[model samples]
Target: MIRLSNSVVLQDEELDITAIRAQGAGGQHVNKTSTAIHLRFNIQQSSLPEHYKARLLAATHHLITEDGVIIIKSQSYRSQQMNKDAAISRLVTLIRELTREEKNRKSTKPTRKSVERRLDNKNKHSIVKTLRSKVRRFFE
Candidate 1:
């Protein structure tokens, strides 16, 4: 079982892990060993709560596929076990992020003092600009 959080635990069977050979240049060892791991988690078919499932699917547009499967590929490590652990940890992290509730923003109008200060600044700026212009008098 993978424990995502205190409330969320994923059954081992829910996760599908595949071992594949790591790509790129790493000598004969990389070519011979299947150190990479591919993890696929079906969001729609999980035991997760309905709201959590909806939130996960909505938040992770890049990670979740159209079919509601989350595909995680981990090949950063040299050993297959390490790669498998990495993939599982990544999946847990993604769900953890979605579990956090977004703090609602409080709608507030500008304070009277601030609004007055802004107007005062605008008045000062206009004064400065007016001074920059040639002073015109009735003597013209």
Candidate 2:
């Protein structure tokens, strides 16, 4: 079983791990060895709370497939075991992120002093523009 957090635990069978060849830079070694791990977990099918499932699905549209599977590929490590562990850690991290509750923001109106300051600035600007206008003098 994978323990996501203090409150959430997922069955071991829920994760599907596949070993695929790592991509980039390593040349033949990268092409030959399947060190990279591809991990897929079905969020909708898991035993997570309804709210957690909903939040995860909503937050990760790119990571989750159309069929509702969350896919994570881990290949930074050279060994297959390391890659596999990395994949599991990534999964745990992603699920753990869902556990946090966003603090509610209170809507606030502009302060009276701020409004007054803004009007003062505008009035000063208008006075400066009036002073810059062409002036005329009459002669008898």
Candidate 3:
């Protein structure tokens, strides 16, 4: 079981790990060994809370498949074990992010002083424009 938080625990069976060839660096070793890890978890099938699932889907649309599986690939490490661990760590991090509640933004109106200052600036700009205009000599 993977403990995401104090309340959230993920079952081991939920995660599907596959080993694939790592891309970039290591020359011959990279071409031969299947060191990269591909971790797939079905978000809709998981025991996670409905709200968390919804937020996870919304936040991680790129990671999710059309069939509702979350795909995470890791090739940073040389060994398959290291890549697997890295992938799982990423999954936990993503889950934690989804679970954390966003702080509600307080709706605030512009202060009276700020509004007055803005209007004052506009009036000053208008006055400056008026002075720059070519005055027509009506007597001419």
Best by lDDT: 1
Model 1 lDDT per residue over 1-140, tens place: 98877877899999989999888779757667899999999999999988889888787568789888999999998989999989999999888887678899999999999999999999999999999999688775
11, model 1: CA deviation in Å? 1.6
- What local lDDT does model 1 show for residue 103? 95
Model 3 misplaced stretches (Cα beyond 4 Å): 25-28, 57-60, 98-100, 138-140
TM-score versus the correct structure, for each prediction: 0.87, 0.77, 0.81
User: For this target, which candidate reaches the highest TM-score against the unseen true structure?
Assistant: 1
- Residue-wise lDDT of candidate 3 within 1-140, one digit each (tens)? 99987888899999999999877768755677899999999989898888888877777467777777889999998878989989999999877876689799999999999999999999999999999999988996
Which model, 2 or 3, shows the larger lDDT? 3
- List candidate 1 segments past 4 Å from native: none
lDDT against the true structure, per candidate, is 0.89, 0.86, 0.87
Q: In model 1, what lDDT does residue 11 have? A: 100
Q: Cα RMSD (Å) between model 2 and the true structure?
A: 2.8
Clashing pairs in 3: none
Clashing pairs in 2: none
